[model samples]
Target: MEWVFWGLAAFCAGLVWFLLKIATTIWRKPLQVKKFSEAQGISGPPYRLFSGNSTDITRMTDEQNSKPMALSHDILPRVLPHLHQWSKSYGQDFIFWFGPNVRLVVPHPEIIKEILSTKFGNYPKPPTDPLARQLLGKGLVDLKGEKWAQHRKIINPAFHMDRLKGIIPTIVRSGANMLDGWSKLILLGASEIDVQKEFNDLTANVISRTAFGSSFTEGKHIFEMQTKQMILAVDSFRSVYIPGFRFLPTTKSRQRWNVEKEIRRSLRQIIDARERTAITEKSGRYGDDLLGFMMSESKEQRRVNVKSNGSLSTEEIIDECKTFYFAGHESTSVLLTWSLIYVTRNEKPETKPFNGNGFKWKLALRNGRLQGETRFTHRNAKRCCSVAFLPMKLGRLSIPAGTQLEIPILAIHHDPALWGNDANDFNSGRFNEGIAKAAKHPMAFMPFGAGPTICVGQNFAALETKSVLAMILQKFSFVTSPSYTHAPLLLPNLKPQYGAQLIFCME
Candidate 1:
């Protein structure tokens, strides 16, 4: 009887302790952190019990996204309503919570420089969530330390201007094929077209052929799976993230897993076939495509046995492929879509073929459309786990570990202080002297990203946009259709929710 009493007492204490632990983690610690940050002059929406600011963010986002926005360059409020609202309430640099986690938004340029530059050592790239890991893998964006350096070195050659220029003919060919279909439609009295869909298919076709060579069809299927996987992963992440629960056999998880498996299997087959070709070919070359550059470096890494450049394993290669397909396919397509919107809006439909110095193109990129938040689609950005890895001093404040840092690209790009009074309006002349002089600070114009880790495929994207748009301008003139609705959706990136409808006029 005495032993039983003692056991019951112990069990009760254990249960109480467990409850306390949950309470402390879910609310108490976050409260303390909030107080400390407030003491440091940083304030945000008051932290809630467990959901924190996520509910507020979701509400604001849902409400804003529920309607059709007018055609204007002032899209920051519609796309990132939470950030737009909070920044107004909490000043330029503020902290917000995402499900009990503290996220610090750094919008000042000096601080952004500190975060992205040499002090980059203090701030590491956040880890990818389960689905994002499947989407991007251990590619350049996710890699760190020597592994990242090695991968960067290997990937450098593929995206080099010379190499990118080599792919120009392929881009022109792909664009021409898509345009030919559009021409047929115009001849058959289909004057109106959804250019958004056209660019999506065009960019997809371009990436498939350029990245995979002879295996483009297989690459397209793999990218399609990744697209489905991204959707499932994002929908699941919109709710509070559970640490180990993603492994369970839930419906969404099962869907994500199925798509991920197909992506991996398809990518693996394509990679293996490429490798076999490299081995069998008498020249021992992997061809001049993106995959070939990595494969060549991989072979060299194995041969030298240096271990310093780091090893590129087979799985790593697969991840890189998925990353490339995801990033390359969508970002370029959205860029082209928005660029055309500005082009058709600002200039006459009969405007001549776009030149390198085309004001509308520059305005599209410079006025916070492409240049604002091209990298920020895919609402699962939280997976990057952008928390402070350790207690670190940022500018004037010393933030604790687990404090997430966000460089709000959209906020910075649309700041009136940086770009004068017409910040939200399309001002192509602002960029006449060049992007550096366009804004108060050069870093304000971060379309691809900033720091040592700026987007590697920027040249590819830029060249493709120029080639594809130039080809279109030469073939047909287009005006915004009356039926077109301007609803910019930001869940997976800034996209036209309805579709960018344009009425094509034969040139």
Candidate 2:
């Protein structure tokens, strides 16, 4: 009994000591970061224990999101209130806490260029949120170093311009299918449709067909799982990263874990089945298409490399598939949705637009680059200034090792000094003169990203977006629905909180 009592006391003391150590580590790390930021003269919002500046950020975000805004494209303030306030207060180069992590917000193009290009290796992609990782997988987006290099090499064939062109018919068919649904719905009169949903489904179907060589019906479960997991993951980013928190049996955690597990299981079965039946001979043409490309690459890499750690595993291939779905589907859909909304609202009667039949419309679209504005930037996490200053110099500022940096795209995009007075307006004509004349700096407009690590699927995304928009434009003329609210909220991805409701009429 005495031994038992002593054991209990010892256990309690050890637990207390362990917790104290963790607490100390957490408290000291951020302070150390803060001290480094201050020494570098990087000012930011005041820091709080554990939560850091996120509480204030959350408060501001909540307050901003709680209210609806008038129909306008200037959504930077509403979407990122903290960044807006900090930009005004501390100027461009400022530090801020994203939960417990200290982030130096670099809005200047020169500094941004240095971080993204000049010091490319120094500013690797920041660690994704654990919850987000669960959903997104350790695919190319999540990986870095040698593994990333290998994955990029293997995946390159899949997104080649030639291969992308092959998928154009699939894209057109998917868009037409969506328009068919809309046609039936709006048969009576002009229909108030959620263009966001329409584009999402369209993009999803397109990606499904393109990636898997199978229709949406086959990959619907995987799509659904990812979509649900993404919602939960986005919510998790609002708080600090707690070690082993994801392992806890909390409802959200459990849901995420279950979804992740199901996604893996479903993908495994699909892959296994795909492996069994092969219509194409394995002559190393990336199997047949995109899905085949990924699967073939993974297998061929394993067979040849054998011992190399660079080659992706079976699980890794599954992850890449998940990443492809979201990466391919989500961004394109958002661009299309925004394009439709803006075109409807900003339709100019003055400009002698292509007023002709479907064939003429197709000819015009095919002849020129689709002129549309995509101001919104979708970055998972801002870059962390964690890299050590090798020779002790980044521009005029001396950045210390372990310091974090965040490149606020929203702030840079809407800067009146950079984009001029009409920066907030949805002006697609800004790009008519080319990117050189678009903004003060070319890096100022980074919708797809900048530097060497710019989005690999950018061409694919652009082509897909143009195709969808062209189909929609050819079919109908759209205007923002009266019920549409211009509340651009950030659920990690910038989206219309109330949905992009648009009224479409057959042209």
Candidate 3:
């Protein structure tokens, strides 16, 4: 009887504590962050308790997602309606709330250069959306300070020009295989096909071979699981983020967890096999591919963690695999898919009149083959962001720590002030002088980003994209399919809502 009384009292005490904590988070902290921003001349859509701007965001996204857009190059309105609308109303560097957290939108190139340029000394990435962290792990994209530097240092040499050169043949081979499949499809009277889907498979194959020494077919299961997890992570799993809601025994949650577990298990097998082969072969080396580079004894040089041999933990190595495949594979695929969209729509593949972009090749079909040079648009017009871990001076404003920041790459890319009147139009001719000379600001055309955190796989992706595009051009000429719907939306990266459907005619 006495035990029951104490138990009830303890239960009441815990319930009170939990309620107080929620109150502080949902009400108190938001007021502090909002007040701090208002003092610095920053403002946005007024914050609503618990919901903040999430309701507005969800409403806008739902509206856009309901239908496809017309075939046009201006994608900002369709892809990121929330950022687009708010940036116009609140100026380029205003603040908004994602739930209780105040997010500062930073779109100007002058300021973008400063934020990404610094070491993780002051600005570190915001805590990743919980679902995303589960999908990608705490790899390079999420790691901070010394740990980031350590992992990056070990992985750097694998992307060196020399190391990447060794993989060019692999890219070429993979592209050829994909092109062969397209030829067979054309022969079988399937002239109208989705190039976006094809490019996704092509890039998957490219990354698998480079990262794990396996072809897409060899690691198809692994890629499939990661794909499912990425979709879930970016979709409803990240909606509004209720504190204890995800841990609920929901059907969707269980499925997501199962997929994630399978991913780690599959990756472990590959790494273990590679290590065993290295030991048995007496080569004292893992191959020269990315994984091989990470597993090498001499490569790391110093012990990053307190492991026996002073190398990266197997877990760290696995996380990086997820990052490279997710980041590199997805971005490059988006680049190729959009490049196809731009080129096919151009109607002319010959040299466009050079304004500033040196020489230009619009998509032209001659003698049943594509002529002229092939270049890929790394220009994502993408959206990603970071947070201020400590108070830092951003241009004129002294932003405080805990400031969440979003760098609107898409908005910056298409801003008329930066890219002239034809900013939104599909003009690959802009890169004629090279990316730097192509835009008003040096950081303006950053398809792969800039500064220290600029994508290490940039060179790898560019080469693969060109290689694949060139091969496809040699094989076929494509135009927009009549059934195609141009609905470019960001599933964390710019993607066609209905998939990039195009019609391939014999070149």
Q: Per-prediction count of colliding residue pairs?
A: 2, 4, 7
Q: Rank the candidates by lDDT, best first.
A: 1, 2, 3
List the candidate 1 regions with Cα displacement exceeding 4 Å. Answer: 1-6, 231-245, 250-252, 348-364, 367-371, 375-391
Winning candidate number (lDDT): 1
TM-score per prediction, in order, is 0.91, 0.84, 0.83
TM-score, ranked from best to worst: 1, 2, 3
Taking the tens digit of each residue's C-alpha lDDT, what string does model 2 give over 1-507?
A: 999999999999999999988776567666776776677777788877777787798799999999998766677778788888887898777887766666666778887788777777776676776666777788878888677889898888778888789889988888888889889889967588998888888888877877777624657768877888888877676556678876789898788888889889988887776776653554443345577888777777778878874466678888888888877787777777666655554554225232214432223221111222233322222234454332245678765554566676666777788878987776556676776677888887776667766777887887887787777777876667778898877755667789999777777
Residues 7-30 of candidate 3 have per-residue lDDT tens digits of 999999999999999888788877
Against the reference, the lDDT scores of all candidates come to 0.77, 0.71, 0.71
Task: Give me the overall lDDT of model 2.
Answer: 0.71
State how far residue 485 of model 1 sits from its true place (Å): 1.0
* Cα RMSD of predicted structure 1: 3.7
Q: Write the per-residue lDDT of candidate 1 for residues 336-436, one digit (tens) a residue.
A: 88887777666654454333333334445553443343533111112223552334577898788656788877777888988888887776777888878
RMSD of each: 3.7, 4.9, 6.3
